[model samples]
Target: MRRRFKLATLTAALCLLLVSLSGCGQSLAQKDILQLDRHSNEITWGVKADTKLFGLMDVRDNQIKGFDVDMAKHITKHILGTKGQAKFIQVTSQSRIPLLKNGNIDAIIATMTITPERAKIVDFSNSYFDAGQSLLVPNGSDIKNVRDLNKPGMTVLGVVGANSVQNIKKYAPKARVLELQDYAQALTSLKAGQGQALTTDNGILYGMAVQNPGFKVVGGTFTKEPYGVAVNKGQRPFVREINKAIKEMQADGEYNALIKKWFGNVPGFNYKELER
Candidate 1:
């Protein structure tokens, strides 16, 4: 009787263990494809809602529209197998990575610069858009470029939590950097005479210049800032799909069409320079 009782207990324990292992395996499988096609046939893509030309919300149409938006949508169609139902989530430069890591966003197509530090935390697609750092100053201002910013007592304004602030130290070691909370605040500070110049990507600076004609990008691109689509680390399948979509767009003229749609007419920057 004692032996039979022990045997029954062991059999029940083994069954429970097997069930637990099976449940764990199913969870892992679900996690692997959580960001794929599981959500209403929609892909939630991260895009900048404030940065004009690249990714901005069109209030009139109630839709986000720009170069990045169009490109992301194109990639979604290729990856998700359709584009009509995908969604856009407004993401800032500081929030893009966290959103992707937390599963709040499927992918980030914001003007995110690919860096080794960022790559360690998130997987980046092949370089999709190539840009460079530039300086923006009031029209007729004396600051010509980054070289002019390397002077004691000169104040350079950059957006907080952006790579631009970090890169500024390399270019202007002697200048004082004042980082604003966001691009809007940075622009306000620039207008209020808080800094000698505002530094960011040339493409973004062009958007600012267009809105405020009094400001213009000077000393053209000093540092290369290659933009890439970001996904959570270890998502190899998603990364591969994004890269393939980008390559297809590049080969089929879709990439150039987006560039022209947003950037073709922007003043002070040569569109032809971005070909290929």
Candidate 2:
């Protein structure tokens, strides 16, 4: 009887703990947001510092800089004003959701594709950038597109936690896939000849091509990847604020200017297509 009572008590305590944790994750109110932004004058954003053009660390200043970084800055200013602070935390594809769910990040502005699966877990703002999946291969390679990858022994590379890893198999059932932690690692493996082709959104592939010559993006596109800013699920107030900021940027031509600043001179990429 005593042992049974002890076990029951432990179970009750566990339940209470879980309930408290669940409530702690409840949606944030507008006032709470204002307090955080005003009290701290800073917002925490998750970003990818290893992915070039989207978010990469600049050696010169040892600071993260890219399209996502710029957008995060502009959004922070919109939310917190010129003196508002924006703190960026490096997050990989696999780590982003967990970090956001744990409250380590207030928002995610990484080159993350908005998908139904992710939407179920976190609220996402409207599509801020449009992209499509494609293949990046070394120059003079015979593999022209994804269809060509559907052959015995052909290997495709993708970033872990990215939908592309699973989506690639839909088009090339016979090909094998290898997932790395980030875009930089995927490209390094590609150059090392570990895989026949690297698969990701064309915009990212183009960025990779710029840094590493002799590699070209082929196979126009296989999937539509709409990039969105993500926040913890049920944060409707925060989501609305982000959407408003994005729209404001578009109205002022800041959106187009940012697109040009990052992707303007890349060969084989048409910046006009991204103009607001």
Which is the leading candidate under TM-score? Answer: 2
Question: Residue 225 of candidate 1: its Cα lDDT?
Answer: 96
TM-scores vs. true structure, each candidate: 0.87, 0.91
Q: How far is candidate 1 from the true structure (C-alpha RMSD, Å)?
A: 6.1
* Residue lDDT tens for model 2, 108-136: 99988999899999889999999999999
- Clash statistics: count for each candidate: 0, 0
Question: Measured by TM-score, how close is model 2 to the native structure?
Answer: 0.91
User: Which tens-of-lDDT digit does each residue in 216-271 have in candidate 1?
Assistant: 99997888999998887767887888899899888999888878878899987888
Would you give me the overall lDDT of model 2? 0.90
Residue 4, model 2: lDDT of 100
